[model samples]
Target: MELFSDDFTDGNALAGPLREIFAVDMTTATGRCAGCGDEGPVAGMKVYAHAPGLVARCPSCQQVLMRLVRGPSSAWLDLRGTMSLRIPMPAE
Candidate 1:
Protein backbone atom coordinates (compact mmCIF):
# COMPACT_ATOMS: atom_id res chain seq x y z
CA MET A 1 0.00 0.00 0.00
CA GLU A 2 2.94 2.29 0.29
CA LEU A 3 3.40 2.49 -3.43
CA PHE A 4 0.68 3.60 -5.76
CA SER A 5 -0.57 1.00 -8.20
CA ASP A 6 -1.21 3.45 -11.02
CA ASP A 7 1.03 6.40 -11.87
CA PHE A 8 3.75 6.44 -9.25
CA THR A 9 7.13 7.34 -10.66
CA ASP A 10 10.72 7.18 -9.44
CA GLY A 11 12.51 9.83 -7.40
CA ASN A 12 14.61 10.85 -10.39
CA ALA A 13 12.07 13.59 -10.96
CA LEU A 14 13.42 15.34 -7.85
CA ALA A 15 17.10 15.06 -8.66
CA GLY A 16 17.56 18.67 -9.68
CA PRO A 17 16.24 20.33 -6.54
CA LEU A 18 17.70 17.69 -4.30
CA ARG A 19 21.15 18.34 -5.71
CA GLU A 20 20.73 22.04 -5.17
CA ILE A 21 19.76 21.50 -1.55
CA PHE A 22 22.00 18.63 -0.52
CA ALA A 23 24.76 19.23 -3.04
CA VAL A 24 24.65 15.55 -3.98
CA ASP A 25 22.51 13.06 -5.80
CA MET A 26 19.75 12.55 -3.25
CA THR A 27 17.49 10.37 -5.34
CA THR A 28 19.85 7.51 -4.61
CA ALA A 29 19.88 8.29 -0.93
CA THR A 30 18.06 6.25 1.66
CA GLY A 31 15.11 7.35 3.72
CA ARG A 32 13.47 5.71 6.70
CA CYS A 33 9.73 5.80 6.58
CA ALA A 34 8.11 7.38 9.59
CA GLY A 35 4.88 5.50 9.22
CA CYS A 36 5.85 1.90 8.49
CA GLY A 37 9.43 2.21 9.63
CA ASP A 38 10.62 0.89 6.27
CA GLU A 39 14.02 1.94 5.05
CA GLY A 40 14.96 2.20 1.37
CA PRO A 41 16.58 4.33 -1.24
CA VAL A 42 14.67 7.38 -2.36
CA ALA A 43 14.79 6.20 -5.95
CA GLY A 44 12.44 3.41 -5.02
CA MET A 45 9.78 5.66 -3.55
CA LYS A 46 6.69 6.72 -5.45
CA VAL A 47 6.68 10.27 -6.73
CA TYR A 48 3.76 12.40 -7.86
CA ALA A 49 4.51 15.67 -9.64
CA HIS A 50 1.14 16.72 -10.95
CA ALA A 51 0.20 18.63 -7.82
CA PRO A 52 1.20 22.18 -6.96
CA GLY A 53 4.35 20.59 -5.64
CA LEU A 54 6.17 17.30 -5.90
CA VAL A 55 5.14 14.70 -3.36
CA ALA A 56 7.14 11.62 -2.48
CA ARG A 57 5.52 8.82 -0.58
CA CYS A 58 6.87 5.82 1.24
CA PRO A 59 6.83 2.58 -0.66
CA SER A 60 5.95 0.46 2.34
CA CYS A 61 3.08 2.20 4.14
CA GLN A 62 1.98 4.89 1.73
CA GLN A 63 2.92 7.62 4.16
CA VAL A 64 4.06 10.90 2.76
CA LEU A 65 7.81 11.18 3.17
CA MET A 66 8.55 14.44 1.48
CA ARG A 67 7.05 17.35 -0.43
CA LEU A 68 8.57 20.11 -2.52
CA VAL A 69 6.55 23.21 -3.29
CA ARG A 70 8.09 25.67 -5.68
CA GLY A 71 7.05 29.27 -5.29
CA PRO A 72 7.97 32.36 -7.21
CA SER A 73 10.25 33.73 -4.51
CA SER A 74 11.50 30.57 -2.85
CA ALA A 75 10.72 26.89 -2.74
CA TRP A 76 9.25 25.28 0.35
CA LEU A 77 10.42 21.82 1.28
CA ASP A 78 8.81 19.59 3.84
CA LEU A 79 10.37 16.38 5.09
CA ARG A 80 8.58 15.99 8.38
CA GLY A 81 7.01 12.71 7.34
CA THR A 82 10.38 11.08 6.78
CA MET A 83 11.98 9.62 9.85
CA SER A 84 15.48 10.18 8.57
CA LEU A 85 17.35 10.80 5.34
CA ARG A 86 20.77 9.22 4.82
CA ILE A 87 22.96 10.71 2.22
CA PRO A 88 25.94 8.62 1.11
CA MET A 89 29.34 10.18 1.41
CA PRO A 90 31.58 10.13 -1.60
CA ALA A 91 34.27 7.50 -1.60
CA GLU A 92 37.81 8.70 -1.35
Candidate 2:
Protein backbone atom coordinates (compact mmCIF):
# COMPACT_ATOMS: atom_id res chain seq x y z
CA MET A 1 0.00 0.00 0.00
CA GLU A 2 1.13 3.51 -0.73
CA LEU A 3 1.62 5.61 2.37
CA PHE A 4 0.37 9.18 2.43
CA SER A 5 2.88 11.84 3.22
CA ASP A 6 2.65 15.60 3.58
CA ASP A 7 2.19 15.96 -0.14
CA PHE A 8 0.17 19.12 -0.48
CA THR A 9 0.00 22.38 -2.39
CA ASP A 10 -0.26 25.97 -1.30
CA GLY A 11 -3.56 27.68 -0.66
CA ASN A 12 -3.46 29.01 -4.22
CA ALA A 13 -5.44 25.92 -5.14
CA LEU A 14 -8.44 27.62 -3.56
CA ALA A 15 -8.35 30.68 -5.77
CA GLY A 16 -10.58 29.21 -8.43
CA PRO A 17 -13.36 28.14 -6.07
CA LEU A 18 -13.07 31.12 -3.82
CA ARG A 19 -13.45 33.42 -6.78
CA GLU A 20 -16.85 31.94 -7.36
CA ILE A 21 -17.92 33.09 -3.91
CA PHE A 22 -16.22 36.46 -3.75
CA ALA A 23 -15.70 39.08 -6.38
CA VAL A 24 -12.04 39.51 -5.50
CA ASP A 25 -9.20 37.08 -5.30
CA MET A 26 -9.11 35.37 -1.92
CA THR A 27 -5.69 33.76 -2.20
CA THR A 28 -4.09 37.10 -1.45
CA ALA A 29 -6.10 37.54 1.70
CA THR A 30 -4.53 37.17 5.09
CA GLY A 31 -5.86 34.64 7.55
CA ARG A 32 -5.25 34.46 11.26
CA CYS A 33 -4.94 30.99 12.77
CA ALA A 34 -7.28 30.53 15.71
CA GLY A 35 -5.11 27.82 17.20
CA CYS A 36 -1.73 29.56 17.17
CA GLY A 37 -2.65 33.21 16.56
CA ASP A 38 -0.34 33.18 13.57
CA GLU A 39 -1.29 35.42 10.66
CA GLY A 40 -0.26 34.96 7.05
CA PRO A 41 -1.46 35.16 3.51
CA VAL A 42 -4.00 32.54 2.53
CA ALA A 43 -1.74 31.48 -0.31
CA GLY A 44 0.89 30.52 2.22
CA MET A 45 -1.27 27.96 3.97
CA LYS A 46 -0.92 24.27 3.23
CA VAL A 47 -3.71 22.74 1.16
CA TYR A 48 -4.55 19.06 1.06
CA ALA A 49 -6.65 18.27 -2.00
CA HIS A 50 -6.71 14.48 -1.92
CA ALA A 51 -9.78 14.51 0.31
CA PRO A 52 -13.49 15.06 -0.26
CA GLY A 53 -13.06 18.75 0.38
CA LEU A 54 -10.16 21.12 0.36
CA VAL A 55 -8.48 21.41 3.75
CA ALA A 56 -6.35 24.43 4.42
CA ARG A 57 -3.96 24.40 7.37
CA CYS A 58 -1.80 26.97 8.99
CA PRO A 59 1.85 26.71 8.13
CA SER A 60 2.96 27.90 11.55
CA CYS A 61 1.23 25.29 13.72
CA GLN A 62 -0.47 23.00 11.21
CA GLN A 63 -3.87 24.04 12.47
CA VAL A 64 -6.91 23.68 10.28
CA LEU A 65 -7.76 27.06 8.84
CA MET A 66 -10.68 26.29 6.63
CA ARG A 67 -12.60 23.65 4.65
CA LEU A 68 -14.48 24.12 1.41
CA VAL A 69 -16.88 21.65 -0.12
CA ARG A 70 -18.77 22.23 -3.31
CA GLY A 71 -21.74 20.39 -4.67
CA PRO A 72 -23.89 20.70 -7.75
CA SER A 73 -26.14 23.42 -6.43
CA SER A 74 -24.33 24.70 -3.38
CA ALA A 75 -21.04 25.12 -1.63
CA TRP A 76 -20.05 24.88 2.00
CA LEU A 77 -17.25 26.93 3.45
CA ASP A 78 -16.15 26.47 7.03
CA LEU A 79 -13.78 28.98 8.48
CA ARG A 80 -14.24 28.40 12.16
CA GLY A 81 -10.60 27.52 12.60
CA THR A 82 -9.64 30.86 11.20
CA MET A 83 -9.79 33.75 13.61
CA SER A 84 -10.26 36.31 10.85
CA LEU A 85 -9.58 36.98 7.21
CA ARG A 86 -8.13 40.27 6.07
CA ILE A 87 -9.01 40.67 2.48
CA PRO A 88 -7.52 43.51 0.50
CA MET A 89 -9.74 45.57 -1.69
CA PRO A 90 -9.19 48.08 -4.40
CA ALA A 91 -9.37 51.77 -3.63
CA GLU A 92 -12.78 53.18 -4.36
Candidate 3:
Protein backbone atom coordinates (compact mmCIF):
# COMPACT_ATOMS: atom_id res chain seq x y z
CA MET A 1 0.00 0.00 0.00
CA GLU A 2 1.10 3.53 -0.66
CA LEU A 3 2.22 5.16 2.58
CA PHE A 4 0.93 8.61 3.39
CA SER A 5 2.60 11.25 5.52
CA ASP A 6 -0.34 11.35 7.94
CA ASP A 7 -1.97 8.33 9.61
CA PHE A 8 -5.41 9.00 8.16
CA THR A 9 -6.38 6.89 5.18
CA ASP A 10 -6.27 8.48 1.72
CA GLY A 11 -4.64 11.45 3.48
CA ASN A 12 -8.05 12.89 4.24
CA ALA A 13 -6.91 14.10 7.66
CA LEU A 14 -10.51 14.66 8.73
CA ALA A 15 -12.20 12.70 11.49
CA GLY A 16 -15.76 13.46 10.47
CA PRO A 17 -15.27 12.17 6.95
CA LEU A 18 -13.68 9.00 8.19
CA ARG A 19 -16.44 8.45 10.74
CA GLU A 20 -19.06 8.84 8.05
CA ILE A 21 -17.29 6.25 5.95
CA PHE A 22 -16.07 3.79 8.60
CA ALA A 23 -16.55 2.77 12.24
CA VAL A 24 -14.11 4.43 14.61
CA ASP A 25 -13.25 5.43 18.19
CA MET A 26 -10.57 7.81 19.46
CA THR A 27 -10.39 7.37 23.23
CA THR A 28 -8.36 4.21 23.59
CA ALA A 29 -8.57 1.88 26.57
CA THR A 30 -5.42 0.01 27.53
CA GLY A 31 -5.54 -3.72 28.13
CA ARG A 32 -3.24 -6.70 28.50
CA CYS A 33 -2.30 -8.68 25.46
CA ALA A 34 -4.59 -11.64 24.79
CA GLY A 35 -1.82 -13.58 23.07
CA CYS A 36 1.09 -12.98 25.46
CA GLY A 37 -0.89 -11.77 28.52
CA ASP A 38 2.05 -9.74 29.84
CA GLU A 39 0.39 -6.78 31.48
CA GLY A 40 3.31 -4.92 32.97
CA PRO A 41 3.54 -2.10 30.41
CA VAL A 42 1.95 -2.84 27.11
CA ALA A 43 3.70 -1.58 24.04
CA GLY A 44 2.97 1.91 22.87
CA MET A 45 -0.04 2.34 20.57
CA LYS A 46 0.42 3.39 16.97
CA VAL A 47 -2.02 4.34 14.24
CA TYR A 48 -2.53 2.20 11.14
CA ALA A 49 -4.74 3.09 8.21
CA HIS A 50 -6.35 0.01 6.74
CA ALA A 51 -8.85 -0.43 3.96
CA PRO A 52 -11.88 -1.31 6.11
CA GLY A 53 -10.92 0.87 9.09
CA LEU A 54 -8.12 2.24 11.20
CA VAL A 55 -6.39 -0.18 13.58
CA ALA A 56 -3.99 -0.03 16.49
CA ARG A 57 -0.96 -2.29 16.83
CA CYS A 58 1.43 -3.29 19.57
CA PRO A 59 5.02 -2.46 18.78
CA SER A 60 6.17 -5.67 20.43
CA CYS A 61 4.66 -8.30 18.16
CA GLN A 62 3.25 -6.19 15.30
CA GLN A 63 -0.18 -7.68 15.90
CA VAL A 64 -3.49 -5.87 15.63
CA LEU A 65 -3.55 -4.18 19.03
CA MET A 66 -7.04 -2.68 18.65
CA ARG A 67 -9.74 -1.78 16.16
CA LEU A 68 -11.61 1.50 15.72
CA VAL A 69 -15.32 1.45 15.06
CA ARG A 70 -17.63 4.40 14.58
CA GLY A 71 -19.52 5.21 17.77
CA PRO A 72 -22.11 7.84 18.55
CA SER A 73 -20.00 9.63 21.15
CA SER A 74 -16.60 9.11 19.60
CA ALA A 75 -14.21 11.49 17.92
CA TRP A 76 -11.36 10.56 15.58
CA LEU A 77 -10.36 6.96 14.82
CA ASP A 78 -7.75 5.99 17.41
CA LEU A 79 -5.08 3.81 15.90
CA ARG A 80 -1.84 2.92 17.63
CA GLY A 81 -0.13 0.64 15.13
CA THR A 82 2.41 0.27 12.37
CA MET A 83 2.14 -0.90 8.77
CA SER A 84 4.46 -3.01 6.67
CA LEU A 85 4.82 -2.06 3.01
CA ARG A 86 5.55 -4.86 0.58
CA ILE A 87 7.71 -3.63 -2.24
CA PRO A 88 6.66 -5.52 -5.31
CA MET A 89 9.47 -7.53 -6.86
CA PRO A 90 10.67 -6.34 -10.23
CA ALA A 91 9.24 -8.28 -13.15
CA GLU A 92 11.69 -11.01 -14.07
Among the numbered candidates, top TM-score falls to: 2
Total backbone collisions, model 3: 12
TM-scores vs. true structure, each candidate? 0.87, 0.93, 0.36
Quality of model 1 by C-alpha lDDT: 0.87
Total backbone collisions for each predicted model: 1, 0, 12
Q: What residue runs in model 2 are displaced by over 4 Å at the alpha carbon? A: 1-4
Top candidate (lDDT): 2
State the weakest 10-residue window (summed lDDT) of model 2.
1-10
Global lDDT scores for all candidate models: 0.87, 0.95, 0.42
Model 1: per-residue lDDT, tens digit, 1-92? 46355676888888987776677899888999989999999888889987889999997777999999888788888999999999898898
What are the candidates' C-alpha RMSDs? 2.8, 2.8, 15.7
What is residue 56's positional error in candidate 1, in angstroms?
Answer: 0.2
